[model samples]
Target: MRKNFLHFLIFIFVFCFSSFSKSETCGGADGLVCCNTITSTSGSVCAIPANNKYIFTLRRFGFENSAGEVTWVGTETSFNAALSSVGASMGNFISGQSLPEGTYVAVRPEVKLEMTVNGSGVSTSDSVACTSGGDQTENLATVMNNLSDPIPNCSSSPNEDCNTGDGYMRIRDTQLGNFTVTAATARTINFEFDVGSGVLFTASGGNCAFRSMGPLDVTMSFSN
Candidate 1:
C-alpha cells in the first residue's frame, strides 16, 4: 500500500509539472498568440490582424440599421486593388460566422462598422507601415481618397486620433497608399495565412473607410 501511494504522488507531480511547463511556453514574446489587448484604432492588440488564415466570423455591435446578410466583394492580391474576384452571396443582414479558408475572391460581405453617431463622420487614417510590394506604393493615395476626409479623420502626425464624427467612423484597408507593417501587424493581417518573410497585407487606396453610424468592426479572415 505504501509503495502504491508513493507512485501515485510521483505521477501527480509529473503531471502538474508538465502542465505548468506548457502554459509557460504557449503565449506572448516567448511564443506566439501574445494575448495582447485588442483596442480601438489599429494598435498592438486591435489593429494586429489574425496571423494565420482560418475560417472566422464577424460580429457587429450597436448598429442603427438592420445589417444585411454577409456577402463577398472580390479578391485582390492585396488591399490596394479592386474586386479581382466576387462571391455569389449578398444580403442585408450582418453577424457573419463560419467562413471557410480560401482566397476570399471578393470583398468580404460583413465589413460592418459599430459606433454611436449620426449620418457619417471622418475617421483617422494611418498606415501601420508594411512592405513595399504589390500595390503598396499607392497606399497613401488610397488612404487619402477612401479613408480621409470622407472616411476616418487623419492627424497631421502619428500621435493623433480620428475625429470619429459623432463618435462614429468607418475604416477599411485601401489599395492606394502603402507601407511596411510591423511584425505585430504582419502577424495579425493574415489574408493568405501564408505571408512570406517580407510580405504582408497593406491598407491603402480607397478602402480606408466607409459610410457607417459608429465605431467600425473590421473583422477580416485569412486564406491560402
Candidate 2:
C-alpha cells in the first residue's frame, strides 16, 4: 500500500509539472489577435497559431509632433529597407506601392497579425497586436529590424514607430523572426497612420531626420 501511494503521488507531481511547464497558447478571437510595440529583446508575448495561417505588421522608427509619435507618411517606403537590413531578399520587392486591393488578400484562410516596437525609456511607448485564429497561429520569431535600405521620409519622423504611441506595432509569435509577405495578400493590409507636420526632413532640416530614424516595425508569418 505504501509503495502504491508513493507511485500515485509521483505520477500526480509529474502530471502537474508537465501541464504547468507547457506554455499557454492563445487562439481564436480572444487568443490570437493583434499586438503593438514590444521593447524587450527577451522577446514579446505572442499567440500560438492552431494551423497554417499567420499574420503580422512592421514599421520604421521615427518621431513626429512635439511629443514624438509614430506616423504613416514614411512607413511604406521604409519597411522594405528594414526587411533587407535583416538580410532578406529584395528581388521584386518595391517600396511606396500599396498592396493590390482585392480579396484573397487575406493571404491564408486564417491569419494572425502582430507588430512590435522598442521603448524610448522616459515615457512608455505603445504597440499593437491582433490574431485571426481559426486554423492559424502568430509566428514572429522570423521578424527582424531592417538596418540597411534607407527610407526617404524617415529623416522627418525618426522616432515615429518606436519612441511614441503614434505608429504602435507588434510581433505575432515571439518564436518566428523576420518573414516574407507576398504581394497577393500584402495588398489587402490597410495600414492607417498619421504624419505630423514640421517633423519630416527638407534641405533646411538636413540630418535632423536621419538622427531621428531610430526604431521600426518588424513583421513575420508562419507555416502550418
Which candidate's TM-score is highest?
2
lDDT per residue as tens, model 2, 121-212: 11101322222212222222222223343222223543221222233332112223322233323211112111111011111111111111
User: How many collisions per candidate?
Assistant: 49, 59
RMSD of each: 22.1, 22.7
Per-model TM-score, in order, reads 0.17, 0.17
lDDT per residue (tens digit) for residues 90-188 in model 1? 111211222322222223222212211111111223432332212222222233345554344534321122333432222233321222222222211
Of the candidates shown, which would achieve the greatest lDDT relative to the real structure? 1
